[model samples]
Structure formats: structure tokens, C-alpha cells
Target: MEKEFNGRDLKLGQIQDGNSDYTRYHITYKSGDLTISGIMNIPKGIPPEDGWPVLFLNHGHIDTSVYTNGRGLRREQDYLARQGFAVLHSDYRNHTQSDKDPNTETDVRLGYVEDVINAVMAVKNSDISSLSKERFGMLGHSMGGGISQAVMVVRPDLVDAIVLYAPVSSDVVDSYNRWTLRNSSNAEKIRSAHGSPEENPEFWKNMSPRTFFDRVKTPIIIFHGTADESCDIEWSRETRELLLAAGKRVELVEYPGQYHEFGATFDDFMKRSSDFFKNNLK
Candidate 1:
């Protein structure tokens, strides 16, 4: 019999007998006296002499834990572990179970990158025998994709390969405006304008992935839905173009007629993503 896990098809009940133990940890990081909370998932597998390839996964924009618990135990981290990779997933500051600092609103702009860096450090320094600091990969979605780009620039030594899904593009000003118009009502738009791009040009520029493309040397795989309304497909195309122009290794896969979440075909997305990571991370 066959079973499905995290939207991926796999053999059912194929239990490998061994000392396999998985643990969830609460990690704290300090950013100038501000502490943030994050979750770490360590899988049970043969202890590699050096270290197993680690994948640091960043979730999309959400205040709850649902984004991290996609398909329950078949979550991204768990799925990666089943594939013999150690995975680390974290909640950004002021989101989910993480610490809520009073200055979060002001510091949120840099929260994603900070959280990921802290997560990587936590895994690298942890006592997990199967985790090595030398072999690491990044997997991010939506807002996390933007964060991944920033991570590649800030911590290039910590990441080996990257996989971005529905990433935000360099045309942030226009994209944000379009998002506001399509998703928010006039009243909501008026309220959002308080922190609009015009007012936060620096933040937009600093966080835009396109600004640091030349600094990214890690190979990348991008997945985008052609029919995505939330984040335009042009972002992925532009990113691909930039990476290719720089003589970097980048692969892009487009899902035709797919919407924001890519509908119920998420299984297909994970399969392709897993293959991409496997091929690139090795």
C-alpha cells in the first residue's frame, strides 16, 4: 500500500528499524537585548560522521502556526527529515509562539532574516551529531522567499542551495501597491498607506531581493504559479533573469493555471521541490 505525507506520495508503513528520535526545541536568540522564540525539528537517522545536510525552512506571512504545520506531521520539516535531511523551522519574532517584543512593529522589517540566521546558528551549534554547519540549504515560501534572498546576502557561508516559492520581486513598490489594491478595500488601503512604500522606501529597498542578486552564489530553484494573484509571476521571471545574467545556477518551474496556493495540487509542488533540493543540495 502507498501513503501520502506532506502532500507527497510515499510508501505506507515502511518503518526502518533503528534508533530514530525526533525532537522539537524552543530556541531563543538575542538581537540587542530583544529575545525571539523559534522551533527546531531534528530527525532520527544514522549519525553521520561529519554532519547531515540541514535545511532551514521559512514559512509564509502568518501570525499563527498553521503555516508551519502544513499537512500536520507531514509538515515540510518532517518531510525533509524522512528524506534523510535535518530540518529547522522557526517562528519569527512576534509571530506564533515566539516572543513579542514591544519594538516588534519597528523591528519587523528585519525579523525574517534575523530569525533565519539565528535558526541556522542554533542548528550548527546544537549537539545533533547528524547536523553539520558545512552543508546547509534554505527553503522559503512567499514572504520567506524574500527573506531567503536576504539571507543569501547576509549569511552566504551558511547556505548551500536555495528553493523559493512564490517569492516577492524587485518591483516591490508596484507589487505592494497592486496587492493593496487587489486585496484591500479602499478603507483598508487608506489605513495601510500609513506605512506605504512611499513612506518606507528604505525598508522596501533594503528588503528587496533583486538588490543583492550579484551577491548570491548559491544555486537556486524557484517555483511560481502563473495565475498567482497575490504575488505576480514576473517576480520569479525577473529573479531568474538576474541570476542567469550573473552566470549563476538557477532553475525555475512554473505551474500553469495555478492560483495563489496553487490549489489542491500542493502535493505535486512538494514532489518537484524535494527533487530539486535533493539534486542541488548534493
Candidate 2:
């Protein structure tokens, strides 16, 4: 938690074909020693007085072997950019062409949280005149939701608002046991490195965002489907309950019969998310 992140040498390159409302660019920034890749979408119109509000887009877990640059969160990026927010979608280290982090899996994805924090710092340290310094929001889906939670607790000053779409448990151990333990040998790998959650309660608690909810500054809104098979709706319910108990501003919007990927309800959630960023980021 005390580590310093120098999000320096941010370079925006290669303007790509974009929708009518925005322009897209490939971007790279320094997260520690590794060069991280991402995409930035800037709205086509003029900027506000304080400049355009920034949204850091955190995507769900993808197999790193198959992941490419700017591979995830395409719809959210387009909708948010079209809504006049400057969106930055980072492909966390060890994914795509970005440099690898050897400790990523064994350390339980904390490196991802660090990369995200650095992405925010990169914006702050950049010479991008169109981006806002104050009004920074975050949108995370599934595994991305978990990363955003850690980011909130670790760097409370960075985000103005947060939208968690079908997030995993704030407790990383739950996610580990649910996915890792049931599916593969990774459970033993992680346990051998950090010890099991039961065996090393202090270590696990220190890493889980649930342990540090009091440090969160952003107003959190979680959207979950009642029938989400990938990520149980109960996870979001527990998150909202914990946040409320911590005296933080939080709300959970449940969608009945909606799945994890939000098929019919995608536009609805996007509209609600636009409203949230508008009210908070403005």
C-alpha cells in the first residue's frame, strides 16, 4: 500500500476510426518500469470549463494469453465517450503487449490495482489539456469491479464516482475459492504463496477491500442481475450492505433475470451510468 506509482511517459498515438461523437487513440503509459497499453476516447465537441471529466474503464478478467490491446469494455467505452466523457480503458499488465508481472497470480491481482492507480496518476501527470483533474470517475465490470474496489480503498482521492457492473466479492478470498479452488490447480499455487484465507486471516484481510471500506470516498452504485450465474447477485448485496454499514454512500440496482453480460439491460445500465457520471463528474 505504501508503494509509489510513477505514471510517467504517457504517450497517445494512432488516431483510429471512431464514431460520430468521439475520436479514439491508442495510448501507453509507464506503470513503474512496465509499459502498459490502453485506449483513450475523447468526445468530438468542445470541453467544459474545468475540462472533460475522465472515466477510467476497468474491464473483466480475460485470459491473458488471448487478450490483446484495448480488447475489453468496448460498449461501455463507446457509450461513455459518446456521452461526452473522456474514457481510458487500460489493459492491465501481463495482458496484451504490455510487459509481464511475474507475481500477478501468486500475489492475488494486487498488481492490477497498482496498474489502475498508475493509470489515474498518468492522467494527472500528463499534459493532456482536454482531460479533467478533479472530476475523475471509474467504471468496472466483474473482475474489473474487484480491482476498482481495491483502487478505491488504496487511493481514495482519485475517483469522484464509481459504477460496479456485476462485480465479484469485495473479499478476494471468496472469488478465489469460488473460481480457483473449484476449477484448477491455481488454488494450491496461491495458497502455497500467500497461505489460505483461513490459515492467514491477517494477510487475506489486509488485501481484501472489505477490510478498508471506511477509506472509500466515491459514491458507489452496483448493478447486478438476480440470475447472474457467473457472479452471484448476493455478492453485490453484501457489498452494498457493508458499504452502508461503513457509513459510505452506496446503492445496489438489481435487474431480475438479467445475466452476467447484461444482454437486454445493457443500454438501460449505460443510461443510468451516464446519469451518475453526469451528476457526480459535472
Q: Identify the candidate with maximal TM-score.
A: 2
Provide the RMSD of all predictions against the true structure, rounded to 1 decimal: 8.9, 1.2
lDDT of 2 by residue, 146-173 (tens): 9999989998878899999999999887
* Model 1 agreement with the true structure over 84-130: per-residue lDDT tens digits: 67666666666654566554334434655776776676655555566
Local accuracy by lDDT, each model:
0.65, 0.90
State model 1's lDDT: 0.65
Candidate 1 TM-score, C-alpha based:
0.76
What shift in Å separates residue 143 of candidate 2 from its native position after superposition? 0.3
- Highest lDDT, which number? 2
